[model samples]
Every structure is written in structure tokens, then in C-alpha cells.
Target: MHRITGSHQVQFLDALHRDHVEVEDRVRTNKAMGLARLPSKSWRVNKGWVLTCNLAADLDAWLRLLTLHDDQELARAEPETMRLRIYHLPARLACHARRRLVRIERTWPWAQAFTTSWARLTALPALT
Candidate 1:
């Protein structure tokens, strides 16, 4: 089984710090979806770790649409940047999102929205 050591945890902490700096710089540069910080914590679950911001904003939009509510306001808004804020999220959240996406696809039959939302949520690191 995989175990997380202090050093491995530090790497993620460092990434969060770096991301804060980058986000601040982006804000100065007038960039949209500038940056946000995720909460920090220690846990021993799923043989790994996860850290991320709650994507309540995006989820709200989806829920609104599903309910035939006023999604117009949400439509004009840009996509959530929570994924970019956190370098990693717990494996459980990832799995949960994946499962939620599957359910959404089954009920909505709109694969494009689900695919785009999943991609946005997963926002893995870019290759150098």
C-alpha cells in the first residue's frame, strides 16, 4: 500500500505556496480566474492524499439547469477555477466527481457539458 511521508506532503504544500505567488502575479497582470488557495490538512485515506477547493459554484450552475431554474445568470459566468487553485485533491473527491459525471451523463445525455466539466475539474499539471 502507498504511504505518504512528510516529505511528499511538503511537496504539495510547496506547490500551494508557489501557486499563491503565481496567482498574485496573475492578479497584478489583470488575468481572469486569477487564483485561489485550497485548505491544508493531513489525512490517511485512500493510500494517498487529496487537496482542493469546493466547486460549489459550478455545481450550483448544473443544479440550476437540472431544475429548470434560472440558469441564465450562471450561463454568463465563466468556468470555475477551483481546480487550478489546488495542486491536488483527495483521491476520494476525484472518484466522487468521476462517479457524479457518469450519473450526469446518464441522466442528461449531454456528453459535451459533462466532458468539459470533467476536464476543467481534473486540470492536471501541464508538461514542461
Candidate 2:
């Protein structure tokens, strides 16, 4: 029911279709993050559940896009693998003076990447 374009239309549609496919892939990831089922009877609670899932998704994206952006292996890892390698990786928490210190195990396989990414993340200017 719409007008047709020239040969450039095929290129534009190809790019658009690729983006749509990527979005569908992300939809599957969001489901993995707990968006698959809203397990609450109350509407308010369901909203909160969605919000929490979005927060998790945002953090996952940040870890990939910012922390491991330049790292080939880690960047290509799935969300579950990423969580296992980075977030759930064992670390000793210590309180010193007025602050806390997270001391990751120096023997871990990805310890160097973890420390390098941590340093880069912290070196960012304060969020005013």
C-alpha cells in the first residue's frame, strides 16, 4: 500500500532488517535476565519486577560495552559466562579506615583483565 523506491531501497531494508534481528536477540537476553515471566499477582509488584530486570540488563550491557569493550574473548562471552567470570568471581572484602577494599584473588585466570577494567572504570571522573 506504500510507494516503492530505487535500488537503494534494498540496501536500506537490509540494514533495517539487521537491526531488527539484533533487537530480537536482545529480547531473548532480557528474557534470560528474568523478563520471561512476571510472577506477581499485583500490578505494582510486576512493575517493580520489570524495573529490576531492566537494571540487571543495563548493568550487563555496561559491563560488556564499557568494561570489556576492547577485550575480544570477554566481550564475546554470553551473559551467564560473563557473570561467572566477573561478578561472581571470588573476592575478599575488607574495611580499612573509612572505606572498603575489594581484593580479588590474584590467581584467577582473568585477574589481569579484571584489574585493568576496574582501574579504567574507576579512573572516570566523578558523576556530578
Q: Give each model a TM-score.
A: 0.20, 0.83
* Candidate models: Cα lDDT each: 0.40, 0.83
The list of candidate 1 runs beyond 4 A from truth reads 1-109, 126-128
Q: For model 2, state the Cα shift of residue 85 in Å.
A: 0.6
Tens-digit lDDT track of model 2 for 24-113:
878877888889999889999999999999899888888778878889988867777777788786888899998999888888998888
Best by lDDT: 2
**Predicted candidate 1 versus true structure: per-residue lDDT over 8-44, tens digit per residue:** 5767779878999866653432222222432234344
**On a 0 to 1 TM-score scale, where does candidate 2 land against the true structure?**
0.83
lDDT of 1: 0.40
